[model samples]
Target: MTITTTLEPVTGPFVWRGDELSRTDDWIFRLGPDQVAELEEVGRRFIADDPDLRTVSAAQYPLTAAAEAIRRFGADMDSGRGFVLIRGLRMEEYDDTLAAAIFYLIGLHLGEPIRQNELGDLIDHIVGVSDKAYEEGGLPSRTRDKLPYHSDSSDAVALMCLRPPASGGLSSLVSGATVFNELLARRPDLAPLLLEPWHYDWRRQDPDAPADTYTSPIVSWTQGCFSMYAGADMIESAHRYPGVPPLTGPQREALALIEEITYSDGVALDMDFQPGDIQWLLNYAALHSRTEFVNGADFAHTRHLLRLWLRRDVGRPLVENFGKHVVVDRSSTRTEDAVRDTQGHFRIREAAAVRTDWGD
Candidate 1:
């Protein structure tokens, strides 16, 4: 397997500066009244049917009026800006069931929803369940820590805001291409190190995983296409396990430099999430993170979001084993048989409900 360490800097629409996007609303797609009404109608009927979440198809809830807009959204994430903020769902009018149903319906149109954990939840509830620190193995989504910029193991990831935090928790994104180009310009000597495989902690995933660690390069360039898979936490934590190679001095420097660049001025775009907003990002093109947040005292005021890891069928070319962390066969763990409550709603995992070392 040959790797292109001296690849030229990537250039495309996916390369963007956060400060530049801040001045425009092009990334935002506001749903129209008709689209919202259509979603509500379909969402209610789907909830009434209460079909298995995994078995439900997009055709069942045909978002006829919003189909074109939805297609454009896919285009934006794929070829335009690598992310989209969908605004305009009226949260007050719907309960948790309706909201989840609606988000699931839209997700179906986007791609196949994959299992997010060992329990096989197609839609994972992201809420802070504890105040534990990440160093203590606390789940990032279950704690109020400042998440670092990183990409998930999926073609695309979606988050629909069900409830916003009382303060902070601002979601931020940085273009991986932009970051790569900057690294090339500033320190070409270190750029090749990114194409070298680095150990990632697979123990943070399912206990039944084949290996305790997996290796993959940070950047992969294939057939003139660029893709990136990054998680500083995962790479750094892998060293704790036996048999994993230690990080060299240059590797440490490269990692530190990447993080420093991600947090540098104008690199990351931050958004204060609002209830009823859905943000979709192409994992290969951009890295996302969150600010430390404060949740309210009551459950009603708790910060909550619905997450989806989508296996998009779009033919985006990628190098072999680029995202080895993503689970491929979920047939045994699929959420088709998830239990439901008397209210005909799937039980959502509470905050801090995840394993401290769980990786997603």
Candidate 2:
């Protein structure tokens, strides 16, 4: 299918609750062995060409017919379903360098990778770096605990699992649009709270960043589309500010209703991720979470997933607050700072941007 770019918002793109959708086929894409080989060849060529142009953009990794499929995948993130599970790669077959490069190559096909944290990590590993969980200000990307249902600070996010746990670390996702609709259906009174601007503690997304916090509403409506910028932990952290308003009784009750419905049977979909599984989510439309898992002792059996935060062209028009972790904004001159480890694994140094990023 030929994809055409447009800035106009797609009105109320079909929203569905967990009970309403069940088939993995609705969103999952499995790459056949031949396609996998072709992608690997693309990675090899990308490396052979520049050998230094790592993780810059998807266009760097030239694709043949595969480009169309990947573009279709991205198109779905905006115009069709808001999430997709691409399975069927044998991660263990490849070493870390090749595996990571391949994942980054796929990400480049989607969009330019943005700084994931103040650390400026373009690609991140989703395994605990410390014992602390995100609730205590530890980075969620490096936590082993449960992540609350929240939209990530990006236009889209991709996770390619290098290794999965033995059991109990299923990824859970709920439609943010569904949450928006549910708030109105159950209690219109609380629905307005979602549109209320709320501050979130930057929590060290940047160490040298100027502000301690930034504000945005949970839900935004613009260009005939409803976009969500929500993170329960961030909203709860906002209470530390004296000026920030507390969640009113109606807001609290409203949030409770949404969460209740989310975890309820048939309302949320939990995924059993396999090694080499790539999960892509449109951050604006999907509220995602992760459950706790038992980690193995060694690298082979341990849980590790590479994460990418990409910003595609033609994103929905958003409000001012929407640009907090702004990747592409009106005033921004950003340059990436990156280097590889002794093992040749790519690492993101601290980054600098105009305003796409607010915290360290």
Maximum-TM-score candidate: 1
**lDDT leader:** 1
Q: What is the C-alpha lDDT of each candidate?
A: 0.79, 0.67
Candidate 1, overall lDDT?
A: 0.79
Segments of candidate 1 deviating more than 4 angstroms? 1-6, 205-210, 329-360
Candidate 1 lDDT tens digits, 1-360: 122335677777888899999999999999999999898898888777777764567877777898988999899998888999999999998877788878888888998877665555577667787756767776666777788888876789999899888888899999998888888888888988888889888766444445778888998887667888888888999899988889999889888888989999999999988999999999998999999888889876788988888889767777767775556522344235434211122332221132343442
Quote each prediction's TM-score: 0.90, 0.83
Tell how far residue 41 is off in model 2, in angstroms: 1.1
